[model samples]
Structures are given as C-alpha cells and as structure tokens.
Target chain A: MNYIFHFGDMWNARGEFVEGALMTLRLSGLAMVASLVIAILGALARTSGPKPLRMLVAAYVEIIRNTPFLVQIFIIFFGLPTVGLRLDANEGALIALILNGSAYTIEIVRAGIENISQGQIEGALALGLHRLQTFRLVVLPQALRIIVPPLGSQFILLMLNSSVCSAISADELTSAALDVQGRTFRAFEAFIVAAAIYFALSLLFSTAFATIERLAFGKRISR
Target chain B: MRSFNAGDVVYLLLAARWTVLLSLIAFAGGGLVGLIIALMRVAQARAARWFAIGFIRVFQGTPLLLQLFLVFFGGDLIGVPLGAWLSVILGLSLNAGAFLGEIWRGSIQAVPNGQIEAARALGLHYGQRMLRVVAPQALRTAIPPTVGFLVNLIKSTSLAAIIGFVELTRAGQQLNNATFRPFLIFGLVASVYFVMCWPLTIAASRLERRLALAYKR
Candidate 1:
C-alpha cells in the first residue's frame, strides 16, 4: 500500500515502448492482410470447391478454433524448426498469427457468403455473367458488407492476441514491457505503461476501422 | 541430447492437471463475478451500468497476457505478494468475467420486452421477474456463447504458464527443452488441448441447434 508509482521510469523507456508498439502494429498489420487473403480463399473453397478441399478447410478451421493460440505459436515457433522450415522468432510469430487469424476469419467470411441470397447469384447468371464473374461482381460485394463488422473485431482481437507472441521472444509490446521491467525493476510501472499503450492502440485501430467502414459502405446505406 | 519418451508424455499429462484446475477456478470465479457484472450492466442505476461498462472495456480491450503480468508482478510492488497460482486464477477470472458479462448482457437484452411486461403485470418484483422469467429465457440464448467462452477460457489457462505456474504449455516447453524434439513434444501438447476443447465446441453447437428447434414454428 505504501508503494510509490514511478511513471518517470516508464517515460524514460519511451523509445523502447514506441519501438515495441510499432512491432505490434507491424505484426498485426501483416497478419491482418495475410489472413484476409487466406480467409477469402478458404471461404471460397469451403463454399463451392471440390469435396476434399471443403473437408480440408473444415478440418483446419476446427483444429485452429479449438486450440489455444499460445500453443499454436509454440508449435509454429518450435515445431516447424524441426521440419527444416526454420524461422526466426518474429517470422514464426507472424505466421502463427496469420494461421490463427485466418481460421476465425474464414468462419466469419463463410457466414457472410452463405447469407447472400441465392437469387442474386441466379440473377447474375441470367445476366450472362460467368461463375467467376458472378462471384466477383455479385456475391463478393454483398458478402463483404456483411463481413466487415466481424472482420474489424477479429482484426482488433488479433492485435491484442499478438501479445502472446512475446512468449517466443518476438520483441513486441508485451516483451518490451517485460524487458523494461527486468531492467528497471519497476514491474508495476512497466506493465501499466504497456497496458495503457495497448488500450490506446486498440482505440486507434477501432476508430480507423470505423472510418474505413463509413467510407467504403456509407453511400449505399439509407441511413 | 535426450529424446522424447513415454515418461515425457506422462509428465505433460500430469502437468495438464494444473491446466484443468486453473480453468475450473477461472470458470467458477468468473461465473460468480460475471453474473454480478451482467446484472450491473442491465441495472437501472447509471453508476452501476457505467461501472460495468468501464470494467468490460478495460478487461476486454487489453491482452490477457498483459493482465496476467500485471496481477502477478504488480502484486509484489504493493505490500501483497500473490503466488503464481493465485495470481493466474485471479487474472483469468477477471478477464473471463468481463467477456462473459458482455455476452450474457446481450442475451438478457435479447429476451423480448413483452415477457418483462407480462411478468410485471403478474405482480412480480424485479428479483422474482429476473429469476423466474427473464433468466430462464436468457439461459437458453446464453448457453452456446457461454460454452464457447468457457472453451476459450480453458485454452487461455495456458497463459498461466507465463507467470511460472508450470501448466500444460510450460510443461511442454520444459520437455521440449530437455528432449529437443519440438515436433513430437509440441504436437502432443496441441493434441491435449484439442482433446480438452473439441468436445465443448461440439456441445455448444448442439445446444445452439436444440435451442433453435425449441423456437421453430
């Protein structure tokens, strides 16, 4: 109860904290883009691809969804090196994040795709659009609208989940906070600062996503 | 220099007991606290609602890893030093409570207003109305998401390892370090988690379908 708060110690380590924050942003950004691509493909495959491909995607989603991301990170960071696919800690962390993020994203995107009315696809076909063109022009646009909100939340969750990457020495925000705590012996201050930074980052990302949602879909809605 | 053996698998399984224990503590503690939070979120008092909102925002917005770190380490900075077991349990419970409260709040709200009015017209008080009418309906909607969160909570108990709890993930790390066989060790680790969680996932979906059937015309 008598402990004095030491914001000064954390302030002095601002550079390290900022660098760590950027690393977090970088990791989540890369994972977000990669997962979105993979999710689109996975959703497509699950929805209309050959039977085995759909089953494969289903298995991937189930396994990833059921397991903890901490174990997934360890499996990628430690287990992959044994298979002659060695990657450094950051690379391993990024790949783990992508794999984990994509599974959830695939489910969200698949739900969105399935929610699209069958009539729309039929209409596109009747208009002489090929299957690919129908999917691209008719199905995808409507699906993206349904998918955006959940996708935004998923991306933010990915950003928060990236904290676990520090388990494998990824040098992100949580790791940087630990390093500062180790060096300064100000565990409370170091973590408080890190938590605040994470809070700010989440708010920033959510606001940016809101803006993107508005700009991308604002015109179509009658609100 | 050593290879993974049956003994290592046994060691990992033994350590899994801590994971199960930690998860149960989190779920029980979180359920108790989360019910309070969910009620507070729906409470008529503005202060109670705001308190619930702020609690949910802080807990949900930050990483569980950071929360674990803060509780374990911050305990020492003050006069109270929490052991790893207590800290991990406290941390996960707080985090899980926030999420469960949010989920339950949504379910409670999803219960139709007509039901509430009907209960009021029957001369039921707030507590009676909630316990007898509202909660029963909300329970149906809440089961699937609650189970989903519980599954996530069980998996997240692995984070207890970071604070030196020697749970399942940490046990895997120690074994892998000794055996230097990452594939077998970590793959075994993942399968253990899958075995623990996959059944709950199936149960949640089945419950959702059952609830849907009850409402079908």
Candidate 2:
C-alpha cells in the first residue's frame, strides 16, 4: 500500500467539523423533545383511546418502523413541495427525524405504560383522583423509570440517524466531512474524523444515560 | 421527462434485488464474523474478551453510514481498492458482526452455568462444549434477534445509495430525478422496503413469542 496519510487537511477543517457536530446535536436534541411529546400522546391514545385512534397509532408505528429513513427524507424534502407544501431541507430533516423517532418511542413509551399494573390505576381511581391526575401522579413517574433505559438507547439511535439528513444537504457532521472530502479529496481522513467524533458523542451520551438510569431508577423497584 | 409509468415500478423492483443480495451477503458475512466475536467475548482469555469488547464498541458506537463511508473510500485510500459493492458488503458485515456478537454473547451467557459445568465435568473441550451444547441453546435465543437485525440490515442497505450504490432507494432517487415524482417514487421505494421488512418483523416477533412460551413450558 503506497497511500500517504494526510490528516493535516482534516485538522485545518476543524471549524466546519465543530459546527457540523453542533448541528447534529441541535437536530437530534430538538427531534428528541418533539418526538417524546408525540410519543407520549401516541402512547396514551394507543393504550386507552378509542379503537380507531388506537388503530391509527398502530398503523403509524408499523408503517414508519418498516420504512427506511432515507426514503422518508426524500418524500418529505422533495415530495411535499409537489403537494403544495414546502419546507427547507433542515426543516424537512427535523420533521422526518421527529416522525421517525416518535414511532419507536411511542412503542417504547407504551410498553413502559403497560408495565404499570392495572391495580395501581384502579387504586389511584379509588382514591378519588381524576383520570389525568391519576396518570400524571400515579402512572407517569413509574412509567418514566421503566422507559428511561430504552428511551436513552432510542434517542442515541435517533441522533445517529440524523446523520441521514446529510443526504438532503442539511448541515450536519457527516455532511461537513463530505464538504471537506469534496474539497480536499481526502475522503479517508475526513470520514475517519467524522466517525471518531460520532463515536465520542455516542460514548458520551450512553455514559450519561447510564448514570441517569442508575441514579434515578436503580434503587426503586416499582411493584 | 418521461412520465412515471409501470415500467418505472418494474425497474424499481428489479433494483430491489441488489438490496436483497447485499443484505444476504452481509448477513452471511456478519454471522461468520459474529460467531467468532461472540466466542471471543465469552472466551476465558482477557485479551480475547477485551478485543471483542473494543470491536463491538467501535462498530456499535459509530453510525453504520460512516462505517460504510470509511470502508467504501478508506479502502481506496489505503490502496486495497474495494469498490462500492465489496466495500458495502465488508462494512455492513463488520457493523452487523458487532451487533450480532453482542446479541449472541448475551444468549451464550444466558445458558445455565450448570450446563457448562456439566459439559466440563464430562471432559468435553471448549469446542465440543460450545458446539454441542451451548450453541444449540444459544441459537434458540439468537434466532429472533438475528432475524430482527436482518430487517435493520435491509433498511440500512438504503444508505448504500448515498455512496452511490444503485439499490432500491437509489433507483427511487434516479426515478424521482427523472420523473419529478418524489412522492410516488420514494413512497414506492418505502413500500418495497416495508414489504420486505414487515414480514421479518412479524416473524421475529412470532419467534420471540414462541421462545417465551417455550421458556414457560
């Protein structure tokens, strides 16, 4: 092998790389919150709403879960404008991430909710608490504990997935690498840098999640 | 631009064959590499265990797309010169290896200690014990998740499009470019994927449920 390594060019592109990483973080963070909200509602409806609503949530989860995110990106970014709705690439990427993330999170949150026994909800009701109050007070805390570990991993997957947004030319770490690689023709060094940043970010997030899991839910075993 | 037509649908379906072919190659390669990594993760030697752990960490911690990018371009830069086909196969296999290794390791560990101890007491070697006893049991647990990962693998092959592999999604992209029917083309691409994946998803769940029932019995 006669390939000479040139990471010097990569080092020179640090600003763009940092900006891209921050873009990834921003894209993922916003998607996480938005999807969590949607998942919570979706899960609630799936668990206890009308049959049609439950079926709608079920279909949503199944369809989104089955399709590739890349296709979803094309549909949103390119297809929507054809239907008289238009969103810029970043907006479309964010929406796609939110939609995709919610399907899985809805399932996760639903499973967590299901883990709460019927008796507890009954007990909360028998205590004369309102239904919403019963949910917020009696159900949510325990459900959150059950859901955190999976939610953490799912969020990380979502973050990793936002890398796909680069396909639509949204400003993210992977795209930053692509831009530099295009300019410098240093594909290997550029991708390695991006991949390393991703690795570090993943480790950082997983470690943080593990700590949160331990501190917040380790001692309490809800019966 | 030519209008979207049945011929385009046929073209898209034909391209799906590459997606399936790539997935199968990765599945086979991943299974082989994964088996070795799983064994290493469960091995008695510290170095073997650590190597397996590090392999899993690197592969799993990074996005699969970046792995594909690295292998696709990194190979050329390093002078190995793997083209898109071989690079995607190698990259997906390695990534799948890490995930499947982790899955199978859990399955291997879940084997009762008494079973392994008895195999040892019977004077069976590591290969004999793992092959004859541990693997049979582990295979049972591994099958559902293995199938589950295959669905993930199939969906992931779409990322090969970004690297310019003309699989199902890439074909959809090409059709969309020509026909300007992103909704029809990409939606059709998604449906093709959904059809390919949903059955496996169902089968995986069914297998999981069956396994759970077996445990109860």
Candidate 3:
C-alpha cells in the first residue's frame, strides 16, 4: 500500500472546481426558485380545482415520487436525444432536477395549504375578494408560514441532489473531482475534496435560504 | 440487430437481484448502526448527543453520491482497498444510520415525559426504563417512518452506479449503451424501482394509519 499524497493537484485545479461549484449553485438556485413557484401553483390546482386537474396533479406527484431521480435523468438526457431533442448535459440535468423538485414541493406545499383553516378562505370570499385574490392574500401567506422550515430543508436537499448532474458529465463539483481523479489517479483525495466541497456548499445554501426566509416572511410572522 | 428479446428481460431481472441484495445489506446494516446512533443521541452525556447531531448533519447534509465516491475511492486512496460491493454497503449504511437515528430520536423524545418519570419513580434504572418501557413504545411509533426510510435507502442505492457498482441503474446503463434504447431500458429500470418501492410505501402508510388509530383508542 504505497500511498502518495498530493494535495497540490486539487489546488492546481482549484479554478475549474470553483467554476463547477458556481455552475452547480446557479443551476440549483434557479431550479429551486422555479420549482417553488410551480409547486405553489400545482398545490393550488390540486386542492381547489376541477376533478381533471386534481387527477393530473395527483398522477404527477405519484409517478415522480415513486421513481428514481437517476431514471428520470436518463429519460431526459438519453431518451430525448433520440427524438432530436438534444440538450447539453447541464440543461438536461437542470430540467430533470426541476421536474423532480416540483413533485415533492407540491406535496409539501399542499400539506401547508391544508393547514390553513377553511373558514379563512370563506371569510376572504365574504369580504368581496375574488377566488384567486383570496388565495393570494389569505391562504398562501398562512400556508407559506407553516411550510417554511420544511421548505428550507427541501431546498437543502435540492442543493445536495444537484451533485447527481455529474452522471451526465456536467462539469459540476463532482464531475470536476472525477476529471481530476482520472488525471491524477488520486481517486481518494479527489473524492474527499469533492465531498467536503459539497458539504460546504450545502451549509452555504441553507444559510442563504434562512436569510431569504427571514426577509420574505419575518415581518408577517412577527406581526 | 438484436430486437427486444426475452433474454434482455431475463438479464435485467438477474441484475435486479444485486439491487435487492444491496438494499437488504444496507437496511440490515443500517438498522443496527442506526439503533446505536438513536440510543446515543438520547443518552444523558452532552458529548454523545453532539456527536450524534454532527453525524446526522454531516451525512444528511451531503449528497449520498459524494459519500459513495468518498467510500469507493477513499478506500483506494488509503491502504485498505475494497471492492465496490463492500464500499457501497459501508457508505450507504453510514448515511442511513445517521438519518434513521435522527428520525428514531424524534420518536423516542416524543414519548410522554410523564411515562419516563413514572418508570423512574418505580425504582427502575435508566437501562431498565429504556429497554422495558421507552424503547418498546418508540419502536411501535418508529416502524412506519423506519419502513419509509428503508424504501428511500433502496432507491438511493442507484447512486452506486456512478462508482461502477453495476446495480440496477448501471445494468440499465450498460443495456442502454449497447441497445441504444434509453427509453425502453431506463423506463424498465424505473418500473422495477416503482414495483420495489410502492409496496413498502403502501405498507408504511397502513402502518402509520394503524398506529394513529391505536393511539386514538
């Protein structure tokens, strides 16, 4: 077991890894924001809409929740290319993450929405507010408050799950580590660095989400 | 060109055996380790509690894929070289243990404080109370979520493909590469996972419902 330690390679390739980390952060941030918006709409559609819309949302949640994220990635990346719908690896990964995140988000958001008392909606309607406006001004605010802690955790999970993009050679942190591992034949060192970087990124993302939460709902909750 | 054949299906099913085996190993190994973690988390010592928290935070906070990478390659980098099978088991078990521990700790703490006080007043020691009183109740409460986590642990084993473990996902990757039938191959892969997970999901839900009913009564 002649082990040669070289911390220098990782330092030498720091720029590439930093670039990859930034890309991962960017992709995850955008996907999280997009999925949250979509989930808010989907949750509403599922709970209060027509039967057909409810069925559609239910099917969406069930299918995605039951399947593996890797298979979903393969469908978008490899399956789409055969139909002349090629996307680069990053785009494919982002699309997959966004789609996957939306289903779980819908479920979480729906839980929060259900926590809102039914009387609140009726009261808003009685006050002359329209259905959409009542949902916007009354239901969603309360739901979002109940859902914030879980929502923060979900965002953290998304940030971490973004590491899966390495499968498609998405030059993200894990892929960068793999590239360096291949070049240096230092698989252990490369992976340790990659794992630490991922942990650090997760911590950073959660802190940022907490800050955003304070800004977004701090006033409402206090008042 | 080899058309969609029965042989391919047989091969894929054969590969699924490893997936099932890996899941069992992970669950069995993780369950034991998780119990220890759970107990330690509820231990009176401050250091033990903090250590459990740190373990959960580190493992739960990072991607399983990265941990798999560390386990797979970290073994190679160090003197102790291991096969992918061993590394995958070790890595998945560690991650599963941390999460299961946290979940079980929540259940343990959820038990009424009065119950513990009653046990203590009856001259039962800490170990006696935990073994005879606290754990039995927590076990019933923890079953459903524990089962749910087991299902998730199984699905997550697919991430082992990145390290070339040749489980279901890797087998699907190999078939897809050869047949250029990503749609069929990966679709099959997902269906297999769905079949594997759906039963556990249903059972967990039923278990939770039963537990809720029992509590109400």
Interface RMSD to the true structure, each candidate: 0.9, 0.9, 1.7
Query: Clashes in model 3: which pairs?
Result: none
Can you write out model 2's per-residue Cα lDDT over B81-156, one digit (the tens) per residue?
8988899899999999999999999999989999999999999998899999998998999999999999999999
> Which residue pairs in candidate 1 collide?
none
lDDT (10s digit) by residue, model 1, range A1-223: 8888888989999999999999999999999999999999999899989999999999999999988999898888888877789799999999999999999999999999999889989998999999999988998888888899778889889999999999999989999999998999999889889999999888888788788888998843321
Residue-by-residue lDDT tens digits, candidate 1, B1-217: 7877798889999999988988999999999889999999999999999999999999988999999999987788776899999999999989999999999999999999999999999999999999999999899899998998889999899898778889899999899888888778878888999999999999999998888898894
DockQ list for all candidates: 0.81, 0.85, 0.72
- Report how far residue A24 has shifted in candidate 3, in Å: 0.7
lDDT of 2: 0.93
Worst 10 residues of 3 chain A by lDDT: A214-223
Candidate 1's iRMSD: 0.9
Q: A125-186 in candidate 2: lDDT tens per residue?
A: 99999999998999989888888888888988988898999999999999999999999999
Worst 10 residues of 1 chain A by lDDT: A214-223
Task: State each model's CA lDDT, in order.
Answer: 0.91, 0.93, 0.87
How much of the true A–B contact set does each candidate keep?
Answer: 0.85, 0.87, 0.80
Best by TM-score: 2
The residue-level lDDT of candidate 3 at B14 comes to 90
How far residue A28's Cα lies from its native spot in candidate 2, in Å, is 0.2
DockQ of 3: 0.72
